[model samples]
Target: MSAALVLDFGGPVLLTPFELVADQPGTPAYELLHQRGPLATAEQPDQVWEDLQAGRITERAYWDARAEQWHESGGEEPDIRAMIAHLYDPPRPELVREHARALVRDAREAGRRIGILTNDLRAFHSEEWIERIEIVGDMDVVVDGSVEGHLKPDPRLYELLAERLGVSYAEMVFLDDQRTNIRGAEALGIASVWFDVTDPDTSYAEVRQLLGLPPDGAQHG
Candidate 1:
């Protein structure tokens, strides 16, 4: 059986929402953070974000708090989906990471199953905008927590992906940006790579090695 390559949607498959907002200053997303507070601004360190990174708070709790703060700042209803829409309305293909796209292409060409396991695809993005994302359609499977009603670290979510992909946990290679999620996959005997957003190339290289694919720029043979 072919091994499956499963990736997290946010930081692995695309430039994280935080990175998108930071890269495009003077945009509505940047202005939302600037006006609201330093939830994302580097100059003004955000304790909430730090806590989330430290694993002191759950990802859901972090977003819930941000939604409340956004509403209090006169943005809109206290829903994370509303906040995500304001930050990433158009959802252009440019939001996807080039390396991620390349990796997926190579993995598919190698005859390996590719899947996206995300906590908030439907929750954070609109159906119209999601349709505009071509990379998402390329996946062999997409297991979304919002749709499944089970988030990462939940064994059932991982099990569901394995079942859908028709692969055993040991036959799957998972990549995610969150340490907690990585640990969860590791606990299930799945080979997991922690995608480092700061240095995506290294992470992709590791994934390539795990998938037994040729190194970047090397001949496929």
Candidate 2:
């Protein structure tokens, strides 16, 4: 009665720039303002964040618009994009790396099969970020959203992963930083752990305990 484990990459294993926006106060809300001008006061920050996340507007477009608006308003400032980049550039959090690799390690020692389930774009596949990470056991399968064009929160993605692993949804354990993603897996009868991601001090040992794995197999920092 071995278990199956699926891990999500974003928030859990990587620090995205959008998550660090609050850290950069000097950067204009829109990159265009610094490059060309300032943004109208009516434009909301949340809207900008969404547009950036969805890739609705190019970073350069936003910066250019900001620069124009700021200049028209007679505000003097530097380029916002460069300033924000310095604050929120994506970097691998070592704690995330350590524990994520450990999660794979623990699952292997518990005699469980391992795989990765992540929402990513073409770059993630092209860059081989999945292959770069060292998992303790062999990754039996990979269900990436960008490759399949079917992202998570869609139960089909989870189903596809289970099919490739040759396991029932009820037999799999899903780990994700997002609660919505976790709920999606649960709806399909997959056991789940809501990884806080930023903290890295998750109760993953409890998951091992539930699987009846030896305590020594679980790693704690």
Candidate 3:
């Protein structure tokens, strides 16, 4: 059966600096936020980020809000806007996996619907960054957590992606590095591949099989 492949940005697509900023257990970023106050106990960082992605807050507003947290904690506030600008500008340090692109090409050529469902920051979706990212190029549907007002594990995000792809929940094959997100997709009856960006081959093997494509070849229609 033909399936819609829903790829994640943070892990399945490419790694970014934000991987640490997220609320991953034992991550230095998460630990730092905890030490910084507000982000630790507050309905914080993640929820605030969701609001930013949902368009409830502008980029400037997000910074201002975050700055307030810094002020309350009396911590040194790095100029994040400046950093975001530098990282996304020309000659950014992003590695586009060659194999991943081939898989996308093969899947599209075989008539499979491809979608990018990501829980990404605002800067990552800027026009300049989007232009540079090839994975987003071949996607039939693109849904961002910030734009959807929902994140993975919430089920709403998957529902929104399904709506965009015009596919049933069961028809979507999702790939994400986070097991929590993978489990979320699984609960929705979506076929899922738990990707470990560190050891991607093991995950890609499952993705290839799910897409009904050969391990290393152009999938013919």
Candidate 4:
């Protein structure tokens, strides 16, 4: 019997919000929004994460809405769609792309079946980011939040992925960057690894260790 592995999209293999705007000032998207009066206090950051996880919105809506909020705070409107297009425009970071590909190749060679369980909005569906990151080509099955109308922690999405993969929940190993999402998977009897893609406080070595892989290509015990 083959072990099934389900990987999260935004963190394990892609540039997270932190990596995307590392050089920018102010807090990252994971931070709590400061009470900036009524106009700037329309949405919470966690709500966006939930929406992403719940399949309530797409990535474009998340970013565009964020940009709108940022503009509203300054009482000026910025071209949010254009800005986001530029943000995701650059080439995929080589280190992440290489490592992810290597993992997939090695896992396949090891006879493990792999799939993707991502809470991506429809915006990400059409973005170059998908192709650049190679999500479409690598995974055996992908349960996209926007496409399926179900998201992480919903139980339905996990069931859908498991059903498609023809595996039981306990036979699956899931990985993600968010603790809440991990907890959700745990509830469904899936073993999980947390990928910390954000925070310079967390180095790549830490990520490697968490995944039970070494920085120098050695396998973890």
Best by TM-score: 1
Residue-level lDDT of model 2, residues 1-221, one tens digit each, is 54787777655454433444334446543332222111223443445534633546543454455445555544455444333334333423341455455666777766787777876533233344333444512577777876787767778899889989888887887777556677788888888887653445544555555556545433553
Give me the displacement of residue 211 in model 1, in angstroms.
0.7
Please report how far candidate 4 places residue 66 from its true position, in Å: 3.4
RMSD of each: 3.2, 8.5, 8.0, 6.7
C-alpha TM-score for every candidate? 0.87, 0.60, 0.67, 0.66
lDDT at residue 163 of model 1 (Cα atoms):
96
| Candidate 3 accuracy as TM-score | 0.67
The numbered model that scores best in lDDT is 1
Per-residue alpha-carbon lDDT of model 4 for 130-209, expressed as tens digits? 66655457788878876888767789999999998888888777777666678788888787776654432233344334
For model 2 the local lDDT of residue 106 reads 71
- In candidate 1, residue 41 scores what lDDT? 44
Clash totals in order: 0, 20, 2, 1
Model 2: which ten-residue window has the lowest total lDDT?
32-41
Ranking by TM-score: 1, 3, 4, 2
Q: What C-alpha lDDT do the candidate models reach, one value each?
A: 0.83, 0.58, 0.66, 0.61
lDDT computed for candidate 3: 0.66
In model 1, the Cα lDDT at residue 119 comes to 93
